[model samples]
Target: MFLGDASTLLSVLNRRLPELGLVRYVCTETSWIESVLFWTDIRVGTSEIVLLQSNITVNYIKRKSDYVHEPISRTGLESIWRKMIELEILAMAFNPYEGMMAKISPTATPFPYRADNLWKIQSYVEDTRYGEKYFDGNFERSVEIKTRVGSGNFFRNEHSFPVKPYFNGQISKIASF
Candidate 1:
């Protein structure tokens, strides 16, 4: 069983990791709560394993997310709704990161953008082949445009610490080698 967008990875695994004997996979469109439950079941080894095989055709899907620091006005919401209707957008998922997320210390994690972020607005467009074009008018052939614009080049511009190597005490061994 897999969640979200795992098609490419699954394909590569089926080709390269044949020794694992992965026969079939179930990819389901799940709600946030359902996704949480599914992962929880897998982590706790409570998931039921059943052998089922069938071809699964997934609909065209596009996802765009943005962090919101302030509330939208009524007029702004109306305009957003009008644009969504024009584009035939399927759904909008609003996830609040304020309560539990804000409680976590910034120094505790490598993710640095959690402190001031209030909510995450995720827009989904599904079932339409031209969904990507309609979802964001700026992209002509790819979603890379949107990513670059939103990312602010943080990974490239900012000073980042070596996470895994340093944390695992393998930096010295790696450097020596």
Candidate 2:
């Protein structure tokens, strides 16, 4: 999943698009800094130079980031998203090898979502500038379900689910199986 300046939005996109491919890069909007805070904190000296620098004192309210200074408008944002889809540059939210999609991870690690449900990354490959190569896993995943009784919702109570390692790259060693 490609992300932008908004981490909040990036998280949401990732969550919603778990089926997407690798999260390689991020396209951010604008970058912000504590310019106002920094400018406001500056103290002018009583020396002669103070007068010369007075003209340079910034308003402190508005400042721009060095790398990204412009904020794309909502319309522009939508346009960019549309363009990305048109270009087929974006896939979907990242499904870590341990969570939903394990068959794609290089490590061939099997992720357990529940006591009986499990997912394993059979195999995968990526085409990098260097070259296409195999991928691996380094995570674990599990899902828990709980039930409780209350006033508005009275019934029984239950909770269970603990993450545990289940699969390793045994498939990796085998060239073909």
Candidate 3:
């Protein structure tokens, strides 16, 4: 599935809706993996930044028949949300991939999550006759968002800012991510 900025996504979704052939879209909030976490351990002059990684998979079977279940009702949506949460928690707490980490990391070299790598191209300018144009125009391609956990500061790949400022409440590191 293509994941991108919301406004761009809305236009993309509108264009692709015809392909789905569904009369309507059942929009659902991200109840699982709700936010990306930028967890840090505080220190005097510096701190280490590590992005929290938790993954999960959800499978829903027919309760009675093969009909597609439309969770339009609050109760139905709640049930689905709860099931998603349960699966997410199970994966995070147990870390099912732990046992296979050694085998996968050393040998397989699986595709990595490159979301954080976007920081490498925070801002770019192209040569124009009149002046340089910002890649995102005047808008920031990425923006900082509060964590769903509502505690520590977290950032998604889209947000364009350095990681070090959030460490000591000071902008010691002016480097853009």
lDDT of each residue in 43-112, candidate 2, tens digit only: 3233447645664322111111122223447797687567656654422112222233433444444633
lDDT agreement with native, every candidate: 0.47, 0.30, 0.29
Which is the better candidate, 1 or 3, if ranked by lDDT? Answer: 1
lDDT of 1 by residue, 67-176 (tens): 88887888988988787677655346567766557888878888655777887776543212353345565333333432324323334533321111111211111110
Q: Summing lDDT over every window of 10 consecutive residues in candidate 2, give the lowest-scoring window.
A: 168-177
How many clashing residue pairs appear in each of the predictions shown? 0, 15, 4
TM-score of 1: 0.39
Mark the regions of model 3 whose C-alpha exceeds 4 Å error after superposition.
1-39, 43-106, 111-132, 135-164
Give me candidate 3's TM-score against the actual structure.
Answer: 0.17
Ranking by lDDT: 1, 2, 3
Positional deviation of 80 in candidate 2, in angstroms? 0.4
- State which candidate, 2 or 3, has the greater TM-score: 3
User: In candidate 2, how many Å is residue 116 off?
Assistant: 52
